[model samples]
Target: MLVAPFPPSHPLAWLDSHAARRREVGLRRELRPRSAADPMLDLAGNDYLGLTGDPRVIAGGVDALQTWGAGSTGSRLVTGTTALHDELERELADFCGAESGLVFASGYAANLGVLTALSGPGTLIVSDAANHASLVDACRLSRARVEVVPHDDPAVVDAVLAARQEPRAIVVTESVNSVDGGLAPLRELHAVCRERGALLVVDEAHGLGVVGPGGRGLLAQVGLAGSDDVVVTVTLSKALGSQGGAVLGPAAVAAHLVDTARTFIFDTGLAPASVGTALAALRVLQAEPDRPSAVLRAAAELADAAGVPAPASAVVSVVLGDPARAVDAARACAERGIRVGCFRPPSVPEGTSRLRLTARATLTDADTALVRRVLAEVLVPVAAR
Candidate 1:
C-alpha cells in the first residue's frame, strides 16, 4: 500500500504566534535585571525582614561557604545532608512549635513534596480557590481527587470533606492569601478538618515572617501550631531572607516525606550557605521580636498611601482592574525611584490586575513618605479614574 505524503508543519512556528497573542493581550513578560547598587526603593521583593542584605545574614552565608564549600553537592539522602542543614531544620521546627521539619530546595518543592507524599489515589484533597500556583500544581500532581472550595471558606471545605467518599482526606490552604493579603480562618478550618477526620495543611509562605506573635505564623497564632492534624509549609526566602523551604509537622510526616517524596529523594538538598543564612536570620527574628510588627505597620502605611484597605500581612495590593493601567502605574512609580510589583494575568485574575507592594521591616519613615508621594502622584489618578 502506498501512503500519501503528509503536509509539513513547523514545530517552532507556534512560539511566535503565542508571543504575538501575549503581546496583543498585554500579557507579555520580560526580565529586567536590576543593578546591585541601584538606589531605587524596593517594595517588590519578598524579603519581609530585610535580612537578605543584613551583615549578620551575609556573614552566616560566608562562614558556611568557607566551612562547607559552596553547594550541597548531592541530594539530601546522598552526600548533601550537612550539619548546617540538620541544625536549620531543627531550629525551624522548634521556632514554629512543630515536632519535626524537612527542608527542600524551594518553597515550590516543599509544597510539592508534602502534598504528594501525604495524598495519593483514593484520597481527597480540598484546596482553596485562591491558593498559590505551587499549591494548584501540587494538587494536579498529587494523584488524588481535588475539590477547590471558595477562598477562606471553612464551611465549603468542611462540606467537601464530609461528602467525600475517600477514606483519607486533606485540606490545603495558605495561612495568608498572597494576592490580597487576606488572612485565613485557620481555627475554623482546623475544627472542620477535625470533625471530618481530615488533615489540614497550611502554607505559611506569607504568614511566616509577617503574622502572629514573634512571626510564628497564623497557625501558631490560632493555637494549631503543634496539632497532629495540622502541617505547615514555609519558605526561607521570604521571611528568613534565605533560599530554601521546609515542611513542619509531626516527626512521622517528616519521615514520610523523606521516604516517599520524589522531590526530596531526587532533588538536590538546600545549599549549606542558605541553611546557615536562614539559621542566622531566624535567630535575628527571635532576638528582635518587634520586626514583624514593623513590617505590618509598613504595609498598612503603603495601603493607606494607595488608598486601599489596610493589609493583614506584609502585602499591600492595589487593584487597578486593567492590565495596561497596572503596568503604567508600576512604571510611573519606578520612574519616581520606587520599585513595586506589577501583577497581571495570570498572576491575578482578568480585570483584577494589580500593583503588589511588599513591606520590609527595615523600611524607614523616609521610605514610606517617598512611597506615599509616588503612589499619590501615580496610582491615585489611575485608581480614581
Candidate 2:
C-alpha cells in the first residue's frame, strides 16, 4: 500500500475560514477569567448547593492536598488509586443507593466509559434528542446502532426498543435536561426498558445533589435506585463542589467498567483533593437536608422573575430565540452586577438560545430580590418583545 504525499497547502489555513464562519453566525466565543475576589452575584455556575467555596469544602481540599500532594501521579489501574478515591466512591454509591460505583476523571469521561464499555456492535442505543453533549458523544463512540428519539417520550423509546434487531439495547437520557431544565419521565422510561429488556442509563449530573431527598439523586427519589437494570452517571463538579465523575449501579457493572472501560483504564485518576472535597460536600448535604429545597425555591423565584415556567431543577432557562439577544441580555445583567449564563448555538438548537440561570442554596432573600430586579430589567423586556 503506497501512501500519497500530503497536498501542498497550509495545514492551518482552514481554521481561519471556520473562524470567520462562526463570527458571521454569532457563534464565536471567548474566555473571560474571573478574579478570586470578584463581587458579581453569580447565577451562571453549576454550584447548586453553594458548597464550592464553603469553609468545610475548602478545608477538605486543603487536607487532601497536604496529604496526597498535587496529582494522582498515574492512572487508577497503576499507582493513582488513593484511600480518598476509595472512600469517595463508596460514599457516593451509598448516598445514591447503588450497590457499587466507579469514579472517572470527569462526568464526560464517565459517560464515555460506561456507554462504550457496555455496548458494542451487537447493541443498540436509544438516546433522547435533548440529552447532554457528552451522552450524544458517548453514543456515537459506543460502536452501537443509535436511534435518537424525541425528548422525554417513553412511547417512542418503547417502540424503538421493540423493533431493534440487536441482542442488547441501552436507553440513555438525562434525569433532568441540562438546557431547558425539564424532568424526564423516569418511571415510564424505566417501565418501557423493563418491558423491552433494555438497560437504562441515566445521567444525573444535573439532578444529583439538587433534586432528591437530602440530595441523594433522582433515582433514589423515583424508587429506582440500585436497580439491576439501571445505571446512573454523575458529576462531582456540580452540586458536590468538586471535580470528578462517577458511574453508579450494580456491583457487576462496576466490576465490568473497571476491567474494560477505556476511559478508566487509560486516563489519570481524579485528583485526591476533588475526592476529599466531594466527600465533605456530601456530608454537608446529609447534615443540612434543607439545602435541596432551598435550591428549588431559588430556581422558582428566578423563573418567576424571568417569566419562564417553573424549573424542575436548579436551572431556570429563559429562551430569547436569538443568540445576539441572549448575549446582550446576559451582558446587561452583568453590568447590573449580576452574573448569569448566556447559552447559544450550538449549546442549544437555533431559535432557542437563552440565558441559563442556576440557583444556589446559599442565595439569600436579598440576593433573590436583586436577581429579580436585574432580570426584570434585562430579560423581561426582551422576552416580552
Candidate 3:
C-alpha cells in the first residue's frame, strides 16, 4: 500500500481556520441533553409509541437489570450471548415475519453489518438517493459498485439492476424515507427486484410502528416478509421507545451474518436494560397496534393545522426552503417550549431545509392543539423572514 506523508508545509493551511465561519453561518451544532424534568412539549425524538416512559417498559428494564445485571459484557459471538438477547431476537423475528434475526448494539451498526457483509468487491448495490445516512455510508464502505437511483422510483432501480454486469446484486431502500416521511412502494419494488434476480433489503427504521398492518412494518404490509430473498433492518430505538437494533432475514442469511458480519462479531451486545424495554414495547405494539394509527392521524392533523401539511406518518417535516431559516424556525419553536428538529444540508438530500417533527402516541388531542399553536407562531417568523 503506500507511503505519502504530508510535507512540513502545504499550501492550503487556512482550511483549519474556518471553524468560526461555520458558526457565523449558523451551521454549528451543540449538544444539550434533555432531562426528564424539562417542561417542554417534546416532538424532536423518535419515540413514536410514547413507550419510553411507560411503567411497563421501566419495570421490564428493572426486572432485566435484576436478572442479567448491567451490560452484555462482550460481542454476541463471545461472552455477550445471554437469554435476554436470545429472547429478544426470537420475538423480533417473529413480529417482523422473518425466519431469524440478529440484534446489534445500535441500528447504525446493524445497517453497516448487513450491507458490508452482503456485498463484496464485485457486487452492485442499487440504493435510493434519499436513504438514511447510515445506508448511504454503508454503500460507500462496501466498495460495491453503487448506483443511487431517484427516490422511490422502482423503474430507475430496475434499470440500474438490468444494466448491471454483476446481477448478483442487492437493492437497498428505506420502506419509509426518513427525511420526507414518504413511503416507498415495497411490493412493487420487491417484484422489480425479483424480476431482476436481485436481493432486496428494506430499512424499516421509520415504518415499524407507523405503517403496515398491526404495526408490523412495510414488509408485512406488502406481503414480502419471510420471503426467500428479502432482508429487513430495524431500530428498536424508534417507535419501540427502547434502544438497540436488529437485522431480520432468512434463516440461512442470518446464520451467515453470525459467522461473518463484522459489526455483529466485533461490537458489544445490546444492554440488558434496552433489550428488556424493547421486549415490553414490542408486546405493547402487538397488543395495541391501532395506537400508531392514532399517532399518525395526530401528526397529519398537527401539520395541517399549522397550514403546512406533511406526509401521513409520525414524522412530519415542515419545509423552510433554506438551511439558515430552518435552524431559526426550530429555535423559535424551542423558545416557545416546543422542541423541534432542524434538518439542513448534508442531513437533507433534497438540499431543502426543514423543521422535522415527530408525533408520539402519548400526545393527546390537547397536545396536538398545543403543537398546532406553536407551529403557527414559529412558522410565521419563517415566512416573514
Candidate 4:
C-alpha cells in the first residue's frame, strides 16, 4: 500500500477548495442541461433576430446538411471550402461595405487571426479596457506592446498613440461593449488613428444587425463601413441567429489574413450548415428590415419598465450593484420561467455586477411584457441586497 509520500496540502488540491469557496460566494458555474423542447423565455442567448429557430433558416440548414454531409472533413484549405462560403463572403462584404470579407470558425478565431497576422514584435496595440476577451487575448498573443486605455476614451487613445515611439501601431476596440451595451466613439477613435498613421480594428460582435441603418452594423451605421483604414469583426451567432464569424476590411488586409492568419490557415472551416443558416438569416434581415427597429423599441420599453436606461444595442444590462445579488436575481428570474445572463467580478469590470439581457427581434408583445415583469420582480429586491 506504499506510494510516494507527500503532504496532503498542495497547490493543485486548492482547486477543489476554490470550488467550495465559489459555492459559498454564489460564483460557482455548472452547466444546466436543457431539452430541445424546454419552454422558457430565453433572454440569455445572442439570437437577436430570432432566426435561430425560424422555419426558413432551419430548412436551409437541413438542406445544407443533406447536400454537404455532417463534417467539413479537413481544414478549409483542403476539403472544407465550398461555393456557399464564397457566396457568404461576397454578400457579407457588400452588405457591410467592406472591400472583402474572410469567414472564421468563430468570432474568437476571427479576432485572433486579424491581430496576429497584422501585428508583429514591434507593433503597438492600444486597446479599450472594455474590449471583449477575444480581442484582449489577440493583443496578448500578437507580441505587440499593448497599452490598456480607459473605456470609450478617444482622447486617451490619441494620447497613447502619440506617446508610443513605435511607428507601426494598431488601435483596437469594440463598437458596442457587451455587458453595458454602451456604444464607442468610433469616429473619434478612427480620426486619432488616422492622425497617428495607425490601424483601427473594431469588434462589432453586438452591433451587427442591431446598430446600423437596415442592420448593416456599427461601422456602416457610423459611416466608417468601407473605409480603407478600418477593420471590423462580427459574430454570426448574434443578431444573425447563426454560427461563425467574419472579418471585414480592405482587400489587402483580407489577403494578408489568408496568408498569415493561423486560425484560418490551421483550423477546419466552418460547417456548410452554418454557412447556409447565416446566409438565410442575412436574407431575412434584408427582407424584413424593420426587425431591428422593433427589437430596439422592445428594449427601450423593457428598460423603462425597469427604471433604467435603455440599451444602446440589443443587450440590456440591469445593474444589480453587487455580485451575490446579481447571481440571486438571475436564479429568481429562471425560477419564474425567464432566463437572463449573470455576470460578476472578473467576468465584468470589478465594480459592475448586473443581469445582462439580450433582446431578440421575434419577441412577441406578450413575451417582452413577460420579460419586463419577470426581470423587474426578480431584480428589484436585489437592489438593496
The model with the greater TM-score, 3 or 4, is 4
Q: How good is model 1 by TM-score? A: 0.97
> Per model, how many backbone clashes are there?
0, 0, 0, 0
Tens digits of per-residue lDDT for model 2, 215-281: 8878888899889999999999999989999999999999999999999999999988898899899
What is the TM-score of each predicted model, taking all chains together? 0.97, 0.96, 0.94, 0.96
lDDT values, one for every candidate: 0.92, 0.92, 0.86, 0.87
After superposition, which runs of candidate 3 have C-alpha atoms over 4 Å from their true positions? 1-16
Where model 4 places Cα greater than 4 Å from the true spot, the runs are: 1-11
Single out the weakest 10-residue window by summed lDDT for candidate 2. Answer: 1-10
For residues 8-117, what per-residue lDDT tens digits would candidate 4 score against the true structure? 58656666667678778667776888889989989888888888999998888888888888777777789988888899999998989999999999999999999999
RMSD of each: 4.6, 4.3, 4.4, 3.2
Writing each residue's lDDT as its tens digit, candidate 1 over 38-83 gives 9999999999999999999999999999999989999999999998
Worst 10 residues of 4 by lDDT: 1-10
Those runs of model 1 whose alpha carbons end farther than 4 Å from true positions after fitting are 1-9
